[model samples]
Target: MQLCAPVGCPYFRGMASVVVEFSAQEPERLARWWADVLGWHLDTRSGTVVQPTGPGVPLRFVVSARAKARKNGVHLDLRSESHDDQNTIVERLFNAGARFADIDQSSDVPWVVMADVEGNELCVLEPRKVYADTGPVAAVVIDTSDPRSDARTMATATGMELAGERSEFASLRPPSGEGPFLEFLESESGPEGMLRVLVE
Candidate 1:
């Protein structure tokens, strides 16, 4: 399983890129819902929707024919600046129709897991320490059917430039370098059946 650089196209522009693929019985509807929620525009030509990223990776949504088998095994862990910020954002997401998942954050860890409209899981994490100095987390590879296409759609919506693409993968980098390179992978068992980010 080799990852590829992004291919040059009209959508390639900025830096960070985050790609998310959804396995839905109704891909177009789900994609449209996410587009509105993320404040992104839909690229009808590509049948994908994108949310532009400011100096960060763009968010993308891909449609799959399969139904979600189970809760996503591997998902994103987004870091928030503070507790108040986390609460505020979480409320916003909930109002936007995001469902909360079970996680024990009261102990020490500073993160919460939540599911999107389709029941795909994602995490909202708090910073490790107060004003902790650290580099942004790189790309997160979610399980998907077509990562390259998804990456392109994200670039279009977010206004981020497409960097390059390799054999089975695509790369998008934002100016801040705070976002991860979203990659799509093919699976024989279908998108929703597996939780592993990488097969190997």
Candidate 2:
């Protein structure tokens, strides 16, 4: 289960690199949507890519014949600077084809859940001190049956530090400690269309 570092990983150890890829029916459109959302530049020269704006991993979208059929196992949680900014981001997303997602989250939760144009769920979270330095994206969360084990595997493979762990979630951050955290969340649902860390 070992993975080498990728070119853009902030803490790359020069072994290999990592990237998060999306399989989309319309790769270009999906890539554009994400690029706009993350304020990243879209690079279509090689493929539909959302180039990393910081130390965060780059996102690449490729064509897929099948459409999304269920909730995604992987999703992004966007960080907001303030309450007003959170509201503004949600509003902008809605105008760009995002819709509210009902994932059984509590009504009192501080985050707003919404699905992207392609039915991928994402969270726009209220400001939190812990994520203040995590750039635009707060975390790349994966739903797993065993959060601790998965988190450990990912942390080891990617040279990330095990940042936190609780009953239902385990989190990791790169050695540099500034990019988005990789969080494994406890869930009963099996993995569906999910994030992949490709090491080359």
Each candidate: what lDDT? 0.50, 0.79
Q: How close is candidate 1 to the true structure, as a TM-score?
A: 0.55
Q: CA RMSD for every model?
A: 8.9, 2.2
- Put down candidate 1 lDDT per residue, 4-118, tens digits, no spaces: 3442222234422234444566666766765665455555565454444332223335546567766553455554567887787678778978898763336555666777777
Poorly placed runs, candidate 2 (over 4 Å): 1-7, 10-16, 194-200
Listed in order, each prediction's TM-score against the native is 0.55, 0.90
Best by lDDT: 2
In angstroms, give how far residue 166 of model 2 lies from its true place: 2.0
Q: Among all windows of ten consecutive residues in candidate 2, which has the lowest summed lDDT?
A: 1-10
